[model samples]
Target: VEAPNQTIAIEQSQSDRSKKTFHPVKVDLPGDQITKVTLGRLHFSETTANNMRKKGKPNPDQRYFMLVVGLYAVSQDQFYLLSANVSEKIIVRASNPGQFENDSDVLWQRGHVPETIVYHGRVGINTDAPDEALVVCGNAKVMGRVMHPSDSRAKQNIREVDTNEQLRRITQMRLVEYDYKPEFASVMGIKNTHETGIIAQEVKEFLPQAVREVGDVACNDGEKIENFLMVDKDQIFMENVGAVKQLCKLTNNLEVRIEELEQWNRKLARLKRMSSLKSTVSEESKVSRCSRATSLLPSKKSVPLKSNKVKLCSVKIFRVTIIALIAIMALCALTISTLCLLSVHDRHFEKHPIYRQVVELVTSSSVALSPSTTTAALQGESTISQSTQPVSRIPEVNFCDILPCDKVYCCPIHLQKVKFLNYEKTNAKEKRSRCHCINCNFIMLLSKISEIIKKKTLFLIFLGIDTTISSIQILETQQSIDSRYCSKNLQCRSGNYTYVIPINKYTPMDVEISLEINTTEPLIIFLCKVTFGNYCSPYSSSQNSRKDFLETTQGRQHIWTLPVAKLYDSAYYFRVAVPGFASCSTDPYFAGIFFTDHYFYFYRQCN
Candidate 1:
């Protein structure tokens, strides 16, 4: 068969296995006008077909025939095969000269040619249908990197990622080491080795963009084709980058805060040193003042005779004047008493003869002694000698005269409950007899001074400095009392102690309790949340009881974090107890409990 623009060559081999040559067969058919052809008598003999079938070879004896069709173009040095079937068209061409030796090599040459091959539609390998531009159904080995399109112009709606949220989500993700099932592993050509990765389901919960649904090719367990959730590791890696950036920012902030705290600690140390030095100086000054006051007191040998005589004369004059004043007070009191009696019993005394006789006798005695008494008083005055030095008299002052008697002195409205006394001012001069008002200004000043002093003293005590003059027993007793009354609902006692922290409705539900404890021995800590006004007991049936043991040495510090699922208007109690037969009464333990929100902002203490 032949055509005007194409040539067809037909060859047939004899039934001998050793024969390598073929004989040409010619058919008288027009190829240009006829689009189809049928050859009914072109078949092998019975013996040849039987031999080929028994050997499982189509042409073991070279008895089969071959058909070679070729199309040649004048402008190109290549051979092409074209197929147009069911509205689909395909064109395969071989341009390599070495492929002409074997006709089968020409079909394989299409893939190996050193030229760019472009596909207008999807291309699939080992797959009947592909849903992507290029898909490989089985494992593929690449010697080089495969890059995806990452040009800025190809992307839209690009924005920055929220690194904080990324960090939070990343923290919530659970990492797992898993091995693929045997059937799936064999189908996917994957080795049964432990692999570390995040679960696609869990990743989807936190970051949906990192997970997607993909058709599983290893679904051979009597199940239909199923879509499996697959995780995009690249997306996870990008999210990890953002999370690391956020972590770096947090680390930097923490470093800054630590530095600031260290600075404050240094300042506190310096202030404490200064305060200690001031206390020492004040003690030395007090000793010196006492010594100077003792030295200023005059001794018996140091006083002069003239001064002694003057003191004696002054004493004598003071005694005589006191005696005279006493006599005058007595006479005046008697006269006043007589007048009061006479006025009350005027009628009764007038009718009584004895009362009249007594009154007349008292009047006659007074009349008889008036001249003698005057002469005696003059004689007494003449006998007393006056001191040469005129003494400066001290004016007497009344209690109400010095104070604000007209109006009450009170603190400000805000501080009216605070009590203050003006005990420093004992006396006031008569010339300056005015009401002295202790106003709010003076009270506020005093309060501020007291506060400052109290703060300084507490600071000193906290630093283990014994600034007070109290005895050790006194200090210990005071400390025990303070510990007993440290909190309203909880009291520190021997053996074990329970501290309750009230979580009001205003507190955030999602918060954490952080404990920083310094202990001298091993301690057991119990934490739980209960209804309001309830205590957390060891044997109680409370929910969410977080119990932990703190194994520590002398002065060893430990930090713990407990995530609190607080209910509204609940009370959370964390108890600290000694392990086994130990007790906390013999030794003091320090604990700082901090309540923080989800973001770790401290707002309250475990008071």
Candidate 2:
């Protein structure tokens, strides 16, 4: 906060006024005071404490402290004391700031700080450029310095990674670009031998349990880096990717074939049950056999001459044997599968993000604890092996459109609990809107934001404003999940893992500007996305007029170009239209505001 000044009779300070200010006086500078500082200003909250209370301790009584950091253009040696009324010392600093080649002009707002320190100074640098490392701590004596990284104090020089094992792996790589791919190589390369020695000492506690887990799974360390630096469309990279996809597909097909074979076994089982020997016995067969003994035709009178004994013909067992053979084959397949999955978990395979996510979901489902309260994410495991499980689709999420701004032309539909309502008339004058959280059961916060454009529109009353925005790109993904069927084989998801959007060609940029959408039971959604930058428009804004938009339609992507003239600041921002009743978020519908060029800005705004 700012220190007290003579705004009571404000005037240009005389040199003597500054000269007379060499007093270490005390002043009660209110913490709530708003000051015109070099940085963008924000108020300090009175309710929050400077320090957190211990686990069970009661909050301390409220007390306030006064502090200020200000600058003046007097002499470089100028100093400022606390105001003549308070007991706190004031900090004043002015410097001809040093320049860094990579320095950005952006100023960021600071928030809460947890760490406490007495006082320390540190500086590290490289000839290349200075890093913008911002660290804020609270309630501590602070001091800082800047230095370069190229210093070769013998102890400060950078070193290369040269572990003997790493070297051997390096030899194995036929790298087109001759680079190492070990996960630790880069981390170790910049460190000197001393650092390597330290790391090696802790190998048992920190290093990988398996080589596959340690290096890039498909290749050794040096080879990993070599392939990493190789040219695009490199034969090795293509083969590797092809191999992975083929493996995944192959596993899925194997599951399906197992299920089909099992079904066939069931059919054979039914045939054997119906073809039982007892059931197949016929009266005619018995009669013919009795009469076949030629003399047996006179059996009624020939009893006295009966030979030893009449042996009953044995019934042949045919179908039961066939059924048993089929069952045994099924059992053998099952046993082989169990053994395969019993193998170790490989880093190359299990380390995949999607695979991990799947495993997490499955573990949560199979456990006693409910998923809602669990924050379980699979982390750091060291081994290389494979396990197969059927992938299942998660439950769908419901989505709805957000309410338009409080304008005369807005459709005025706000989500209520499972319903939509129009409060445009009753709450027309209110600044903050109170709407139903929509069908999605979350608050739809509303506030008015200012949008002032200077250009005049062709229609005297209308200024040229296009409120178009990109539609939320939706996708449907089907995955096989039933354990009973999946347990039989991994190939069960033959055509089940199809993408909703059958992309003609997947581009790097296309994949980057993407997000999964919302879905319930039937419809699945994915957002066409851009990162938090200047390339896209905002889907929702607190400050912008919606009435400026001309054409409002459905089933198409809307774009608007915000030209240089339309921009109010170098970091100008625009909002995307929040579709009515579309349980939507700024993230899914908004590409965000990134300025690649004046032309790209126009592309989004143009008709």
User: How many steric overlaps does candidate 1 have?
Assistant: 0
Model 2, 188-216: lDDT tens digits are 33322221111212222322231122222
Q: How many residue pairs clash in each candidate?
A: 0, 50
Q: What is the lDDT of candidate 1?
A: 0.40
Worst lDDT 10-window in candidate 1: 594-603
RMSD of each: 31.6, 33.7
Candidate-wise lDDT, in order: 0.40, 0.28
| Runs off by more than 4 Å, candidate 2 | 1-258, 270-287, 292-607
